[model samples]
Target: AYMNEEAVGKAIRRSGVPREELFITTKLWVQDASYEGAKQAFETSLRKLGLDYLDLYLIHQPFGDVHGAWRAMEELYKAGRIKAIGVSNFAPDRLMDFLVQHEVKPAVNQVETHPFHQQVAEQQFMVDNGVQIESWGPFAEGKNDLFHNELLQGIGAKYQKSVAQVVLRWLTQRGVVAIPKSVKPERMAENFNSLDFKLSPEDLAAIATLDTKASLFFDHRDPNMVKWISERKIHD
Candidate 1:
């Protein structure tokens, strides 16, 4: 949710949504990757959101003192402040490393997953490791003109769905969780409606062929990306 305090406060208050019915998730920014810093960041996020506990907490990136931050997250989970803890943007190797070294296994591993960048091997690894796969860019953020792609559009036409809906449904059908963002209520409804229909095995295979096995966005392993991320700081 981009860590905007005011937006979160208003969302919680205006919706009047029961906490249990809602799955609230927030990330521990890279700047707060230390042991104590992670603890303080968690408390501050809770205070800002006016919540007693979080539904899901995630380490935003794979960089920095991740082990230290994860230790704090593990404690928070044990303390009942966080129901589930996970990591985001972690490659398979790093995710497995964290899982092996830590006492508590991560409940989820969120990454960029779409028809264009299906991440087949990574998804299989997460599945084998018993970690839930969540997609950050299910629609590829319109990269490579994903919305207008003939393959996805054709698949959607079969079920009277939009390209975005088809993409979301395809991911969920593979047991992958998707977080599709849209400011418009109609678009939000469209994304949610994906659960109403099911894709056939043939259709799934057709969509699978669209996988390029690469990220449409910046690579996490790139030195430039690392430098850019390391320079930023998120306030407590």
Candidate 2:
């Protein structure tokens, strides 16, 4: 996963970016979901990332013995080892169940969000729980012609921006934290440029209409899908 102490340390040193200004994030895989396992995993991640502390640390999935992991996260947070704790790929029901039992409230819920699978209900649920919504595949993993869609293209044309920028702006306007992935410098700059433009109410509504109530990937609600995910090795 390229997420080890040496790799993170090397990347940090070569990144030439100030650590203080960046919102550092890392995840705890399901395989490491345990009181001791989560504690060890976080410490290892910190050592790898070459950071004294993390801005946010997330549980990577809903399955596994996360209740036990949450305990460790709470301890780490109390000790000031991590600033914020969150979860990823957790459905609203599962998240609520966790919240009911955990002492500390989660700061955020990271998920796969885009026009195709806008996750309106999930986002609303997180909001109600005071958990921020952080998007993982904000671009939907380049599936379903996201970049070439006519609606998105038209919106981009109006603002003289790329489709990517329009989508990012829409999410940001909705108060969603978007982490768009891009390897190229130009694309990275373009992605960050979403902050410069704003999508109008009408445009936001139009994008909302683009929601097909479908995900380009597996449906987490399906029991088979959940089972499949549960069986997959975190390290595999």
Candidate 3:
């Protein structure tokens, strides 16, 4: 919701790429986590992105009137305004409740996932529930020196890949969609190249040892974090 959709739209318009070849996704912010608010937020996001329809639209968080927001999203999906609708930062309990409460199930659950804070159980939970697990912080935002991690570096050495590529490949091997952000063209290309090779079973097992199973970032279930997140407003 805080993303610069206008800039993304501008870039897309100038890229000479067809709309069908690109998949655009945006989310409804906490302030607009209500039935009518979600409708307006969807339109606002669409206008900002200069798009007539969205490939994926997610409720940014599990807070606020989530059910109401889901209702709005369901209506939009049914109307073909959004091809898919899902959520982010939703824990298993919240996600289960939402699933039971709603008619349309979530297509994805984007959460903090990486080698350091490997969401193995979380990913399996989403998998069992038929939701795709998408990793937001696949590198842990450089926390704990993920770039120079010896385990990752050793694994990369085996495949003649960079540490970043190794990490991305590991996530891929686990069937989680890792969105490892990079600014440099070379880095982006390297990230894309991770799909070329597969991590061996031994390499995968070794990477699994790097998992701490705890988020390097703040806990989403913490009361203080929830309060802080819910208090923030991006809209006028």
Candidate 4:
């Protein structure tokens, strides 16, 4: 998400933010999912970001040698190098399978979630398994003209908040962690201020009705999607 070493370095320098106060997260790319490769990748990421340890590290996807990667991550966690280890884009079934086989369960599951694609079932499953659900495309990447949605706007009017803020607050109120991205500082502040207002139970229920229960993006279960993602190498 930070893109590269330069971006990460710039952020670290400009923010002057303390390491302990920042919840830094990085991921092991699918290309580096093998057991040894995972270890190497972790070290590479640390060096690139100029950090001794990460607050959280995640398997970028459920592809490649995930079992081997998880084993390596578990070792890193036990060694106190990573505060938390998780998996991203893992479906409920894959998550359950991984949980059943491993002694160290995943701390978080990052997935595509928003008002449109609420992932209600998956969220409940994660709750049942004691895993935190984090939303990656929390704003749905602006799909369905999310910014101008009447329902979200109406809710924002009640709290004098922006549509984006309303959506973020809704997610957090439901106990889901949201990662909303913005290049502008003002927009970032708006998102950060979302926690200032609490949505009413009726408003939350209204937002819940917007769920289509289907991903606006690609389906991981589709064989074609799997092949497309698998053939592309992060470094190649």
> Candidate 4 residues 93-143, lDDT tens each?
999999999999999999999999999999999999999999999999999
Which residue ranges in model 1 land beyond 4 Å of their true spot?
none
Instruction: Provide TM-scores for the models.
Output: 0.96, 0.93, 0.98, 0.96
- lDDT of predicted model 4: 0.92
lDDT of 2: 0.87
- Assess each prediction's global lDDT (C-alpha) against the native: 0.91, 0.87, 0.90, 0.92
Which lDDT tens digits does candidate 3 get at residues 93-173? 999998899999999899988888888888889999999999998888889998898988988988899999998988888
The runs of at least 3 residues in candidate 2 whose Cα sits more than 4 Å from the true structure, single-residue gaps closed, are 1-5, 234-236
Please say which candidate is ahead in TM-score: 2 or 4. 4
Error of 3 at 130 (Å): 0.8
Task: In angstroms, give how far residue 124 of model 2 lies from its true place.
Answer: 1.5
Q: Top TM-score: which candidate number?
A: 3
Give the per-residue lDDT of model 1 (tens digit) for 6-119.
578678989988878988899988898889989999998999988899999999999889999999999999999999999999999999899889999999999999988998
Q: For every candidate structure, what is the RMSD over all alpha carbons to the true structure, in angstroms?
A: 1.2, 1.8, 0.9, 1.4
Model 2 Cα shift for residue 150 (angstroms): 0.2
lDDT of 3 at 37: 97
User: Clashing residue pairs, candidate 2?
Assistant: 5-48
Model 2: how far residue 174 lies from native, Å: 0.7
lDDT by residue (99-134, candidate 2, tens digit) is 899999899999989988898988999988899998
